[model samples]
Target: MGISVEDEHGDEVDRIVAAWHLERPDLDTAPMSVLSRVTRLARRLDLERRAAFADQHLEPWQFDVLSSLRRAGEPYALTPGALMNELMVSSGTTTNRIDRLEREGLVVRSPSPEDRRTVLVTLTAAGRTRVDTALIALLECETRLLSPLTPEESHRLAGLLRALLLPFERPRTAGPPRG
Candidate 1:
């Protein structure tokens, strides 16, 4: 058997898989066909996210913090501990984010109304505006990204992704994160 020629329908990963298959014929490279596309798509999406956030003068982490508070609805405040968990950052990191956002006047730290001992991170009006605007920009970019797919195809893709993600979303004995 000979190495496969580049096919018109193939993308970069297909070329890579062909090269790898020729080099290691004994190994099955089937998973690469699916996973490589997903990985590439994720990176592209992250770029779009960064561009959208940049337009709002926000970084991804800042958007993460502000969006969490915005999603909390009226008053848009959450305890620092709650923000730490929701943002999935260490308490110290959360503090640093809050400090930076506070400095920018996008958020404020105030004594919790229910428990004065606790501090709440509240989204400032500016924070709300920035996150909301950024969110709209992101969705527009994402919609364009998915424009090639039909609505049905998009729905099926979402279902497939959810199935793939379900196990990771569950609590289990912690494993080192996947690359």
Candidate 2:
């Protein structure tokens, strides 16, 4: 079950209530029933995901790097710059993560033949096996978590989420807002 903003002493909820009171006293913040629970549940989910990864002797970031390559198919490689963008991390941070994965023999750095200055990171055979195993386990864990919901319900929920997300995915325009 998800936690609530009114959990325990309700400190977080109280702050949220106070903020609404000060900013928009006419509006009720009861919508937090869903939003607050989502926030709390997301944090818990992160911990759960990390634990799952750890069980396979992988860190969450390691899984991310390896899985990204695994998903690329074929050559199973991507540049550090591309990875930094996809992973939403700074160049230096992506480099550090890649360095750690390389040290663990999960990935290797190769010079890009097309661009001598650029490098590509590729998952090793061992990395491929480990990532595949971890992915299967992760999917199983996710499936068990969603067991309460039917497959149709899961699809509907995904559609609903994408509907809510699509507006934000579009590029923002500076012109006057359209009705």
Candidate 3:
């Protein structure tokens, strides 16, 4: 396939790839063209997220926990295990986060009604308010980031990224189970 240069000016990744190509003529750096962009975009997004949450006096981890609960619908509570799964963190980390949030009066821990032995983490009113505000700020930041792209372009980009991500999202099974 022929590579087309769309614009006159190239970004940092383009420069990096050019440098690598000049340094290692035998190596193929095609993957870096896409993955480097993704990596840099992720770093920028993390900065944006931190700034948005800071405006609401929330740390990113706090926002992660609170947002998970906020998305859980009415009552806004979940087991620590559920939170761990949603946040992709370990049990000890989730426990520590819950403890800190509880101390801040953002969340409260109570016995699960369905199972007395289990504990549920419920978002306090303050937690809900903070998470709601942070979400608005986050959306605003994200919208600004996508301002360069038209809505249609953004939609198409999202679809392409999802397609690229599908392989990682699938389970490690050989194939679909037969009934």
Structural similarity to truth (TM-score) of each candidate: 0.89, 0.78, 0.90
In candidate 2, stretches whose alpha carbon ends up further than 4 angstroms from where it belongs are 1-26, 171-179
What is candidate 1's lDDT per residue for 119-140, written digit by digit as tens?
8889999999999999899789
Ranking by lDDT: 3, 1, 2
Candidate 2: worst-modelled 10 consecutive residues by lDDT: 1-10
Q: Which consecutive 10 residues in model 3 have the weakest lDDT in total?
A: 1-10
- Each prediction's whole-model lDDT (CA): 0.89, 0.81, 0.91
Which of the numbered candidates is closest to the native, going by highest TM-score?
Answer: 3
Residue 168 local lDDT, model 2: 56
C-alpha displacement of 3 in model 3, angstroms? 10
Q: How close is candidate 1 to the true structure, as a TM-score?
A: 0.89
Tell me the lDDT of model 3 at 60. 92
Tens digit per residue, CA lDDT, model 2, 1-179: 13343456555655675566567868767676456766876787778778778777998888998899999887899999889977878999999999999998989999988997989999999899999988888888788777889999999977987876677556557544344
Roughly what TM-score does model 3 have, to 2 decimal places?
A: 0.90
lDDT of 3 by residue, 1-179 (tens): 12323334788788778777777869999999999999999999999999989988999999999999999998999999999988989999999999999999999999999999999999999999999999999999999999999999999999999987877666658564333
Which residue pairs overlap in candidate 2's backbone?
A: none
- The candidate maximizing lDDT is 3
